[model samples]
Target: MDFGQIINLSLGYIFSPVTIAYALAAVGLAVHFGYAGLLNFGMAGFMAIGAYGYAISILSFGLPWWVGILIGCVGAMIFAFILGIPTLRLRADYLAIVTIAAAEIVRLLFTTQVFDEYTNSADGLGGYHAGFRGANPFPPGTYGFGPFTYSADQLWVRVFGLVLLGIAVYLVWALMRSPWGRVLKGIREDEDAVRSLGKNIFAYKMQALMIGGVFGALGGVVFALPSAVVPAVYQTSLTFFIWTILLLGGAATVFGPVVGAVIFWVLMAFLDAFLPALAAVGVLPITSIQAATLRFILVGVALMLIVIFRPQGIFGNKRELTFVK
Candidate 1:
């Protein structure tokens, strides 16, 4: 086994756009479920809307890159408001069910042939990155050391994605430390109590939903920056993966998603790179496909162990969790 290659592959995910995107999505999940106790199971819907909104604006309306991003954020907010208005009034599980179903609805809509003119249906859209790439400051060259390097485009993506993630972390930290955040936490513990205190619980929940969803949208935008906006990326599993990242790092903590994203993706990269190769070389007892499936099994087992023991997660406060009640 090439230990050096293993290390490079692992660290590569540490700075990849995919990991940054998941970290952002996990942060949004933290806001929805951890702070406000809203079970949003359609985070992929937000991402899909964000990605499609940005891509469509650029490709159809000839909008500027910044304008496209604005469209993406606004589109996601409108989607969340529309989705939340009816569903937020119900039980958390209701929202979860609706959201997950809604996500599938969104994905199917993207795959539908009716909207092929704009959506491109299954083929999706590409070459939308030209405007984004025009904004790149890199001078067209590779940047990195040894095998652990990225092209100018890749480095630009990482830098921009990280900046967005940092801003998200700061904003969430500030919001959670304020009076507004307190009310959200209170609502999480007991909605009746929060309602009794004369706060607009529904409005706050809506705002939380929209705000958290914008993060997911932004994540989706960044996620597609290095790739194309394919319909397949907006599946339910993407939402679950973000949730896993949130749980692994601690749902309520400010930096949990960032650390969790890095760790989860790095571990996945390591496992994906080494285990299969080992198995192929007859040093391990699994096939290549089994190795791939086993990574997911490992993630599940890890989650189970965490829930069985430290359900609060690595950086989470046990006090913040109301599961006992």
Candidate 2:
């Protein structure tokens, strides 16, 4: 079954850019749902704005890679403001509905032909890597050992992703320890009480939305670093996957999203490798394709189990966080 090969492939995801991307997005979700009790279901839209903003700026406007990233962040914050202005004062469920609809709208807009000159419509955007690659300090050589080994380009992306993740983690950790964070938690627990205490609940929610949306946008930038910016990649399923990661780890905890992303991707990588191998060896009666599909079913079951048995997640305090509230 080539067990050794499977192990190496699965373990390599520990430092994968994809994992870092998801981790970054999940952390943003944590800010929305975990600490602030905001039901934001349009994170995919934020990511798309980030990826396309960065790519389009570089390709069409001749901007620097760093400026493209800044544009992406600003784009996401603008999106958050647009979404939050009318909805943040409404029920949480309303925010969810608006977000999901808004996300789909964003995707369709990118898929439409009107913006083809910039977005390229459904064909997506690429070839914006030159500036980013030019900034890579690593020489042309392989680095690391075992499952962690990678060429200079690969190493550069991973290192950059890790640095961004670290900064995000620190920012979230620091914010959660301050007065503003306490107000956010209070709003999450009981908005009416916070309002009674003279807090501007709407403003807090807007700020949180913008901050988290920026994080999600950064995640999109990372997701596109090693690949092209395809509109199809920002579907609703991506938001659900980030939610799963957030729930799997302690949603409210600073490091929970990071831990959750690592575990979820590692398990996915393992299943992706092992399931096909098992089917090939006749260990599983299903075909290789079916075997691959089963992994998602298993993940769905795992998510249900986590929600039912431990809604607070691995690092979440039961009293501080729960899906039932």
Candidate 3:
């Protein structure tokens, strides 16, 4: 069954750009559902805003790559403000509904013909890598060992993604340790009690939303680093995947997202490689394509098991499982 190839393929994802992107997005989700008790189902919307915002700024507006990143972050923050305003005071389920719908709206906007000049409509945007790649300092050469090897450009993207992930982890860790973070937790636990203490629950929720959105946006930027910006990439399924990663790693813990991302992607990569090989060897009663589809079903089953048996996740405290409330 070529287990060696499967193992190599799976191990390669341990530090892949896609893993980093999911980690960043999951961390943002952790901020929303884990710490703030926000049921944000539109995280994919924030990611789309970030990716399209960065691509459009550079491709259409002729902005620098750094400027495009700033625009993306700002765009996600604006989206957060828009989403949080009317919904923050409402039930958590309302935020979930609005976010999921808002994300689809964002994806469709990019797919529409009206903004084809900027977004390239359904074809998506590419050829914007020149500016970002120009800033690479690694020189022209291959790096790393075994399945982890990469050319100069790939190495540049992975290094950049890791740096951003590190900064995000530090930021979330630091913020969650402060008084403001304590208030966020308090809001999550009992907003009415916090409000009784004269704290502005709405403001805190809004701030958490914005912060998490910005993180999601940064994740989008990283996501686009290695590939083109496609509307299909930011669909509702992406948010669910991020949620799976967040819940798998222990949502309230600082390093949970990163750890969870690594584990999830590695397992996915392994299954992606192994399942097809098994099909070729007639080990499974399915075609290679059908075997490939089974991984998704496995993911769904895994998520259900986590929610039912280990809702706190690997790193989350049992007491911090406040999403049920």
Q: Candidate 1 residues 1-325, lDDT tens each?
A: 7888898888889888999999988898899988999988999999998889889999988999878887988988998999988999998778899999988999999899999999999999888999988999999998988645888888898999999999999999999999999999999999999999899999999999999999999998998898899999899999988888888899889998899899999998998887788888998798988887788889888888877788788899888876634
lDDT of 3 by residue, 1-325 (tens): 7788889999999999999999999999999999999999999999999999999999999999999999999999999999888889889888789889889999999999998889989999998999999999998998989999999999999999999899999999999999999999999898899999999999999999999999999999999998999998888999999999999999899999999999999999999888888899999989999999999999999999999999989999979978543
**Residue 39 lDDT, candidate 2, scale 0-100:** 90
lDDT of 2 by residue, 1-325 (tens): 8899899998999999999999999999999999999998999999999999999999999999999999999999999999998899878788899999999999999999999999999999999999999999999999999999999999999999999999999999999899999999999999889999999999999999999999999999999999999999999999999999999998899999999999999999999999988999999999999999999999999999999999988998878774576
Task: Give me the candidate number with maximum lDDT.
Answer: 2
Lowest-lDDT window of 10 residues in candidate 1?
Answer: 316-325
Name the candidate, 2 or 3, with the larger lDDT value.
Answer: 2
Task: Report the C-alpha displacement of residue 98, candidate 2, in angstroms.
Answer: 1.3
TM-score of each: 0.97, 0.99, 0.99
Candidate 2 ranges beyond 4 A from true positions: none
The order of the candidates by lDDT, greatest first, is 2, 3, 1
Q: What is the lDDT of residue 161 in candidate 1?
A: 91
Q: Can you give the lDDT of residue 269 in candidate 1? A: 92
